[model samples]
Target: MKKNILYLSIAVIIGLIGGYLIFGNSSDSSNQKITEVHDHSEDSTNEMWTCSMHPQIMQQEPGDCPICGMELIPAEASSEGLLANQIQMTENAMALANIETTIVGNLMEGNDDGVISLSGKIATNEENNAIQASYFDGRLEKLNVSFEGQVVKRGQLLATIYSPNLVAAQQELITATSLKQSQPALYKAVRNKLKLWKLSASQIDNIESTGEVRENFPLYATVSGTVAMVMAAEGDYLKQGQPILKVSNLNSVWAEFDAYENQISQFKKGQKIKVATSAYPKKEFDAVISFIDPVLNSSTRTVTVRSTLKNNENLFKPGMFVSGKIKGTAQSAEESLNIPASAVLWTGERSLVYVKPNPNRPVFEMREVTVGLRNGDNFTVVSGLENGEEIVTNGTFTVDAAAQLQGKKSMMNKSGEKTMTGHEGHLGMQGDSENKSDAISTMKMKLPMAFQTAFQAALKPYFKMGDAFVASDASQVSALAKTVLAKMKAIEVGGLGKMEKSHLSKSIAMLDAISSSSDLEKQRAQLVVLNENTVALAMNIKSPTETLYVQKCPMANGNKGAIWLSTEKEIKNPYYGDDMLTCGSVIDSLK
Candidate 1:
């Protein structure tokens, strides 16, 4: 609920604070116009609105934002800076996003050392674990330890069993007793044989003194611990040395963390680590790294680093997600310059951050930095930064987005100048293929070639699903959705920018929803949103080799209109299939 309000407050804060800042000493009538300011032309006052969260949506009148369902607010365009790669944001916009910045100093000048963060989970202490098993073959007559997590004590009565072997052994003792006078050696051997089966000496003496045979016997607990698993059931036949329960001592537990292959050299046994858990967020438990796995996990490329934690207070539970913080990443005696991890945008081998050239203004420009040793949530900047510089520590994505919108240098657009194709409409919706316009006013950045080429390959199955949808074959759509989803998942996201990642993630989610159901209407409904995101993604591709046309059907999405990408300029409507085949116009193309 609070998150929803925060999103809504962005527009409200911008409208209120921005209205006063832009038009001070204005009349109440002029201030009222701020809520629904006109776009397109000066005479078109209150005639249009756009989404606050999604700026792509531009409608003729006020309505709920189609993408996020938030109420539409009047759109405002801001001018870019004259300097290269520089962009500015209004104080209202900054306040609306709740963006914050921090001035970083060289850690090399300070005495503080960096800390390493590790992700792991709590596990049982394996050394203290034991198995409780039966000593001899028998039928379980009764079981006292019936459930997992049950506590047991040493020498406690655990179960009762009926053993035919013990019954026959008793008969042997009875028969041997008669010959004891003549065969004292046989008597001694029979008594010692019962001991091998874990029978008490008193039990052997009772049968001999009473001259009777016992069919049932009691089993006792061998160790004291909490039962981790119950392996046996009442009335079940048990074999000799068969396990009945798995028990583990809870006095101490193991906090095992998976350290990446690159981070393995920094970790060593006997190093002190401070562990924190979600259950106890405020507290940190001190533990020593007792063991590190000798072999690295081949698939995960990580090694298990184990720490023994005392749970005398019963604070830790097995399977709880935990984090381990290790200090001392600083190799140099003098601490190096470090900034919060959030301040850096890491893409492949490069690290980028938005630096405020002037400390007093909201101006920001992207800078590529060389990062060295990383400690916990901070990274040491080896180059491209200076002490006393203010960098964006939060809302880095927002700032990058603002830069891209203003045609300034961004994570996606590394160049200081705009790159454009003479295409009409921002999202390929304003003009048909026959009437393509040369208006290239918007920031003309395209998705990187590596990402675009990979995505194009993955979208092959997606286009096939569109064909299936055009044929009204729900089953084929479901199958193709799964195929495309797999291909999409296989796409390498290591070098993709944040915006590309978001679009790809959303497209994958839409495909998942489409494949989960076999209903044609439901699949088409998901396709509507899928096409929107994919179409936006396709707009980012620069000079694509494969031809892809953005086709739109006016009657789709309940008359709100929708667009889909196709390989050819010829439109085949997937929304209505046979009902409205070839009903769409080609709005844009990628070639």
Candidate 2:
């Protein structure tokens, strides 16, 4: 009996030990799973997501871009190993944003003409200006020169002046002439005194011959010019050497151009310039740089560049708008480099440009550049850029936005400061759900009613395609996409605005992408972009022919969320047709 009790006890002890070993591990695993769940929830709350194309979009969770419909990316700071000023952009983001780059080439190599255009106006040549003054004190009796701008020739009759002193001098001359037989020296002196009064030899001889003193004396013009100013009025008393008329020789004029301080080096005296004017746009006049003012204009921050032009045909007029083109004197490739002005971002004193160091891939780094003279669309890079480098010329703002999101040196964040989750800085949609509700609020243009009508008229086939996608028929979707693309293209854009046209063209690109794909999911992905443009267009319509409901599926687009327009209020998500058929909600309505 003792041995039997001991065997039972040993068996029970082993069973208890085995049972404890099995159930304890299972319980610890359950506890570990709970812990992991709690940790994952914390991470989800902490991590932030943002769109690569539209950096302004910030959400607490991963989702599609509200503005551009691109996939959201982790809005984390770039690695410390990378350059602080460098930014990394996905290939898809670059393509979708239409970011284009230009290869920086030698300014002289690319531009053979090497001409800089300058805006200026025609002015009177001060060197050729002359003032007509009275030789003696007098009162104007008769004014012959009628008005300003009257053409006058040398030795032409200007006006008649009545001078008391001239009448006395004429009487003295007559008296001296009467005693000429007795006093020959006195007669010669009297004639010399009349000559000193600007009287011609014939007039003095006539006075002596007639023996009569004239009350009024005739004044003649000494220089040929146009009357610019009539200084004295008729019958007004005038002092000796007082101006009668201000005359300007209009045969020659000055082409005065405003040159910025940076452009001063490009100009020098005697440089050839081709001047053109709006008055005679078909003709160009040759001019030479006569002078460059040493002083700068404080108010305008410019210097005066004067060029002499001949106006024999009277084509050039004072105060007329003119443009001048000067050929670059130093055309060698070594002198300097040029870049598109659009590529540069100007800060108060600093200028910046995004440079792609690697030609094969889309890797960009911010480079602070020192820019000089601006020649129309291009700028001279005095420093901070090299030849054969590629720079972002178009979509510069988008690139800077990417840089700011990535915590790199950007136009808005030049110090490479890390953005605060990108939510506070950018006025972004807060969460995934709210972003869907605000997706259609991208931007609306004031389109013409005619364009809006035509745009709505073309949506019939597109609406059918949406229904086809919801039915999960890939073939039907592709076929209808072609029709939609054609219909959208066929719409007349007689009064469409530029922004509206850009949206239409971009939507066409999206449709082309959708029509060429045979896969349903791919078509749906492209449709997101098309819907973005379409919804914006619909929002501009005051009375759309067909009402549209902007429906969104939070579980679609890789669980990132995607939106589409539907005629029905019911949620029928085309993104995940039949799989999660009613997995969306109506976020907006357009009528």
Candidate 3:
């Protein structure tokens, strides 16, 4: 019994040792697997999703961006190696945003000269203009050149005049011819007097031979030209030296460009200029600077630069808009890093650009650059860039927009400042405090049916003026404003309440102010005030016939905000015209 117990104890000890070895290894493997699974779950939870457009939005799960309503994408992990101002983007995002880059090189490399751009209009050359006047007082019997723009040539019969004084003088000449044998000096004096009246020697001799006085004298054009103006008509009496018509020689025309105060230094008399006109877009004409007006137009803040161009083909007409470019000398050629104008973002005085640090990664950083001269489509880099560096030439705004959303350094915001959370940021409330002014007053009083009808009638011309402003037609705007003012004045305010009368009177005063000024910018400024009153009036009247949209442009009135009434919901910004034609939103819709 002692020997059997010893064998059983040895076998049990061996079995226990094998079981411990196998189970210990298995437990270690199971713990290792659990740790790996835990790490993966933590990483997944930490991953963030953001919108490509509105990068400010960050969420744990895939969703849509609240701002732009775009799908959320996996937010790129922040690389510790990147600068604080730098941002990394995915290749797919860059492609979607159409981000493009160009290698910095000699933008004016091949060109030996620099160029100065100019804008102006073709004008009648003053040197070639002529005024046709009558030499003596007479009743105009016939005017062959009846209208402006009539082409006349030298020695062409322009008109016939019946002058009693001329007839008496001709009769005196005939009587003197009969007395020539007795009084030679008197006859010579009479013949010379007729010669002074532009009568040919042959005509005097014929009158003497025929013994008759001509009933009327024919006038001829002294020079070849196009009639600019007709000052006199048939049967009209003109005094001596009175202008009959104004003519301009169309063989050549003047191209007068307005150079801003800052750009006057770039222009010099006798410089060669290459001019192109919208009327003849494919054709280019060459001209030399003839004169520069010493006096600057105070209102326009520009000096007139004049160039004479040959108009033998009559290609250039007066008032035709033209653009010119003056080539610069080799020394004047800009010798600096030049980038495309689209690459730079201008906000107040600050100019910003995006620089890519890594060529392999789609990463860009907002960099402030000092700019020098701007020529055509390029800007000379005075500082802040190096040669051969790649830059975002196109879709720069998109990159800056993304940077702004990320709360990184951007064009509008110099520092990485966090924006307001909800309505404030969405409504662009972070600018000048003056922009916070309410657009309209709360004085709402229903107007009489007569006043409403008249006010509605006045709106036609007002909207026409707005369209003129959108077209950038200053003269048209002024004319339309005048019409609106007239209609406003003609409005019958009888039987209207005191509040309605007050609103109508205020609108009339504003319309008068708008009409009194021909300056488009000044008119637009007044239109802002007019718009506020009109909004109040619309609120009071509530035209039953049409729907009006009260649109607000945040960039107008020096960014203090301006409102205008539009018939359509789509924005047609009149304040900035084509510069920011689609820059506003419908703040209120009324019927």
Candidate 4:
């Protein structure tokens, strides 16, 4: 009975301990699973969105970046919340920033002629000039065609000249006529003498028959045309073989043109050319090249090309300025893209054009193009683009500005350095340096807000009082000018496309001029103009991105300027000139 009772107790205790161990393990496992679920949720909340190359992008949801087409990453939530300086924008703001995209298409294209407008002076055709000269020594006793541009006809009597030589020749012919009755051989000799004096056979016969001497002889017009040169006047003595007047036949005139050395090859004899004159702006006359001068003019760096035209109305006169075009065919195949010269942003070495994926969107992408022969205003794209690409023509400058702000490729490098591209370097600038004073006057007289700020500070010294600058002080003046310039650089004046950094480079160069200025009065005068120009440029500036695209600092020798003073990673801007420096920013949030 005792052994059976002990066995029952042992069974009950063992059963109780086994049940406790099993229940404890089950509760621990349940707690662990709950913690795992919570950790997983936290991880999902902290997920980030980033680009494969540009990790700066941060998005709440998964999407592709408009700039690089990379998958977006989730932003890492900061313990401090959103930074005050950060560009945290709503979806609407993003749209206003023009952060949009479009699809590309393919299509056929036609060859377009580029119309190059060159400002030139009007001139007369040199070959059409006529000079009338006295055939014998005589005195001009009367005048017929007096003033310049007098029209005359062929064989018309221009002037009567009293000539002793003519009288002597007529007497010799009479003597020969008298001697003919006695000695025929001596008569031939006297007839030859009169002929040597330029006496015609009819005049000789009349003089011989009448036995009279005419003192004044009538000079006939050599050609039927306008008198181009009049050398002899009434009462003026003219020598033998001396030119007294010039007449040209306007029935046909030669159009002489200056052909540049490079363009000389395009011209061939008998090729058709179309000529236009400012005087006759609406009319176009056709001419055929009769000759291309074999020799090139070293001084003008051109070859002379001659084209003949019929001047039936006598409208195309000698010395009348005219311009003409000759169509040239290229040996190679035509290009894929067509663009206007104005559409390209010249960066010194490379030609850049902005392409819009969609016309509805204001933004665009920068494409470096290989240019072929320029027909006129249009440039043929030998490579770098396809057909049906929409290019920005009128508002290229505006589009370029937006690209620069968005940190995309631009016409110039960050240092404001330019690239060499085709014949674009030869084209004139938007602001020509030839008329510096005119451009400066236009800027200062208007006094736009940005220009006022930039110029006021830059010209403060000059405005306050006369100042002198030496070459040694050039760098110092540059520093002061840089201060105001930096501020002006941040502003966007228009929406043309993109601004070339070179445009601003000229403004920056003014600072160097200020430093080197030695004469107070002279330097001050120049500085005034410079200040006005700076102000005007500030007002007209289109994009701050231009500064980034061409960040060329003149002092590039280790002390050179930087494209971005700080890396894209850094959030603070030491370069910002105003409180609104970050306004309208179109950048991705940092993860």
Candidate 5:
């Protein structure tokens, strides 16, 4: 009985030990799996973040962009599945950019009828123009037409002139009439002489019958038209064959449209045209093409197509703008592929379009397309696209901007050059080295104290303008620019030498360019040029009472770099303003 109890105990203890080892190992394996799953969750949450404006910046966690200071968003997914020239945009980005797409199949199917649109202006018909000239040399006594655009009728009295020669001729005619039977030849000669002065036969006969010599001769208009110009005023002396006024019959006018070289083939003499004008939107003018200019205007790259319209109501006036549409038969209406003008992105000589590779994804690839004729709002695609392919139409520039940011093949950067880092401190101060020579030369040059005072006074408004740019106040910048222009003009250059005056003149010109611009970006761009000229001027004749810091920004003017003058050593970049408030460095100091 004792041996049986002991064996049972031993067996129970062995079973308990085996159970403990099995359960303990199983619990440890389960905990290890849970820890591995938790670590994966943490890794998934560590997605990279980046800025949309400054795409080069990357961060491990969400934060503001270091350069633009904009809130960073999740970085774009790895571009492993994208083509070298393709980019993937999120749906939210597409909505923000207003990007729209359309299938490239039969876009012009119903609309392809070979209708050419043209833009031109109304002009006076040169054929209906006439000039009224004085028939005899005399001094004006009475004038009928007072101003241009006065309506005149044929044989109407235009002016009355007093002439000693006409009086002598009238006296000769009266004397000759007395001896008509004895001297018929002399009488005929005197009558013919009076006819040369445009005198009426009745006037000559009355002078002969009454034996009176008239001193004043009345001039009559030969043509009925509106006076276009009045060359002579009342009491003005006139000479024979001198133009007194110009008249034009507005019963007919010309609608001249410019045709580009490629469009010249579609136009021909006697082609029918329909014209409309903004002045009379409801009315349509119909006419046949009267003439097509044989010579092309090299400067305008256009040829003039003229059509004469009957202006019975005189509605069409010279210099009024008009649009025309030329109706023609299409040579291949079924084979045409046309896209909207907004879809095409032109850079220098290349035309680009963002083509959607897959209808399911937001992946777009930059494509170079061959373009043909330009219809009203569409362009005919010559090649490079196939049917059923989708393409971006609106917001093409936005896509190009993104492509440029991605360092992909874009309209401006066809070679896929890497984007330049324009951050203030990313590159170790690039422009300082180039301006060192200028700074050395400038430090050596000196000007008279009076000239320096005037120059410094002229720069006060400019400094204010820089501050306005820093504040991003466009209106304030415009006002300050004008004030700067005024101060620059008020600068006395009489004390300046020839070279100094020339330099000052160039600087003033650059200032004028900036002051005239209403666009802030354009003003900023002009400011870059103005800074260059101003720096050169300052180098030669810097202010003595104040210290000027010449600052440079590598990110300005499309990353080509720009410089400006500031009074402080700390940089307040005007080009970028709040977007990149501290995006520049002081290149040199001027005193």
Candidate 6:
């Protein structure tokens, strides 16, 4: 009877403990669910609708714009919504987008001096030039403005012309003076005829008094300036209505500058420019924009900008090399955000950038921004982003790829529904599957020619060396390896894409192995091994991936050109083993 009673008490204790644990767990679960539900509901209620083209307008509900009938887009929940065209993304999506943020302070003021100096040469002001020509028929005589660079004043004697026509008119006047009594009307008509030849009244009176015709007549200057050119010198036969001299006002000069096509918009009329010259290093002359060439130079692909400078001390001379800083105001007067030019993805029509939303999570979204003035590598942000927002300045392509994967409007697409292929894989981090999707989209954008050349040049040497090794040619292999090193050393790889750098890095590493080989046999053997690896890499390599053919190629002596890529395997070459591929691979490869 006592054992049964102990068992009953233990069972009762166990039941009570089970009941207490189940109820306590249920209460905590209910509280957690309630908290989550409250946060989700708050987010749903605060959602806003905005126009993609007009981000400043915000509406509580989704609808068409009263002004423009364009569809409304969803606004980001964070401060990103305040930006121009911020596209919100999830944490995982952001990681795939490669959206990176950095902390930066506002530029309260900029230094008066420009960070970069542009050099150009001084030239004649075409607008202030004049050409002197004869108004009447003339012959060989004398020229006052004998040579170029001679100064002349207004009404000054330019040259003396001997004209048979003028001599005949003078004789008529003298004859008329003697025959005045016989024919007064005929004398008056003869006298008036001489006036039509641009003769002075004093010269006519001298002709009548002397009763003889002068062989040579003097010509006077129309305008005062420095003689730029003397077409006719002393004792040269001259014709009627022919240019005699070319003159220009030296008081004002033109400083012509060649601006890159990308920077043409930054220059305009009436803007201020501070000019200095290596010839006169101590002097800093001030000038203002007077004219900009309407057309771009087809050969140089640059725009010509002309600034007018007053040459008070005759310090500015034509053809003198000069350096200067241009102080230009933003095209838009309204205050707007500014970011590094490297942050923008220019797609010809629209400009895009990735803005970090959460600094703690390092999350960002793709945003379409309007740009105003492009001052060097920096641009003025007219719209699309707000102050205090984190932006991706470096590795913009990396972040743009991530955006494409997330189905957000990226540098390539806005809907994010399209799959972009055929992009040359550049260098950078690959986060996950989603990151790959985004990277593929971002790669669709075309890169600058300079960047493409740099990427390919890096891989040329490695591939060449690897091919040489595979062929079992010890001398050729050694030469090829050394050539790769020389090419890499000579190549200027300072600025390039991330994908390009990654491929080049791999190719360069392989070249480094070849370089360290002590003997020809050893180098050949290593190259053979490298060749197998390179072939394998080529099979798997994707388009839009950095390759050497676009930048660099092999050389006859195995040495690379001065401007080459660091890697060699990434070069996409069809003539891998073809003889004489190196000699003409690149144009002017020495430096």
Best by TM-score: 5
Candidate 4 ranges with C-alpha deviation above 4 Å: 1-130, 181-186, 256-262, 273-287, 295-305, 313-315, 318-326, 331-336, 347-349, 357-365, 398-591
Query: Which residue segments of model 3 deviate by more than 4 Å?
Result: 1-50, 54-70, 76-84, 106-113, 117-121, 175-216, 258-263, 276-286, 296-303, 320-323, 330-334, 407-409, 419-591
Q: Give each model's clash number.
A: 4, 0, 0, 48, 0, 36
lDDT by residue (1-591, candidate 4, tens digit) is: 999999999999999999889998898889999999989888787666543223344565677643234346544343233222111222332332233322222111343233221112223455666777777888999988887778898778888999898777777777777678798998888787767655567866777788978888887776677777788789998898888877766677777776655655566888877887756789988877787899976544457787777778767766565667776644422323445554656653477776665454333567778876444445557777776677656434434443333344555444333332111121111233343211111121233455435434443443222111222233233334434344434434332222323544434434333332333433333343343234334434333322211111111111211111111332222122232232222121111
Candidate 5, residues 356-469, lDDT tens digits: the string is 999989889999999777666667788988778899986675576677778898765668875432221122122233343222123133467777777788788788999998
Best by lDDT: 2
The 10-residue segment of model 6 with minimum total lDDT is 556-565
Error of 3 at 279 (Å): 6.2
Candidate 5: the clashing residue pairs are none
Of candidates 4 and 3, the better by lDDT: 3
Positional deviation of residue 480's Cα in model 3 after best superposition, in angstroms? 17
Q: Which pairs clash in model 3?
A: none
Task: Give one digit per residue, the lDDT tens place, for model 1 in 57-176.
Answer: 567778765433456776555444547777777665576545789887843344346567776778999899999898888999999989988989998999999999888888999999
Off by over 4 Å in 5: 1-72, 109-112, 328-330, 420-591
Using lDDT, rank the candidates from best to worst: 2, 3, 1, 5, 6, 4
Candidate 3 residue 284 C-alpha distance from true site, Å: 4.7
State candidate 4's TM-score: 0.49
State each model's CA lDDT, in order: 0.75, 0.76, 0.75, 0.51, 0.74, 0.58
Arrange candidates by TM-score, descending: 5, 3, 1, 2, 4, 6
**Native-referenced Cα lDDT, model 4:** 0.51
- Local accuracy of candidate 6 as per-residue lDDT tens digits, 167-241: 887787787888899999989998887776656678788889878778888887878888998888777666766
- Ranking 4 against 6 by lDDT, winner: 6
Q: Write the per-residue lDDT of candidate 3 for residues 21-80, one digit (tens) a residue.
A: 999878988998998899988878557987664456678888755533457888877655
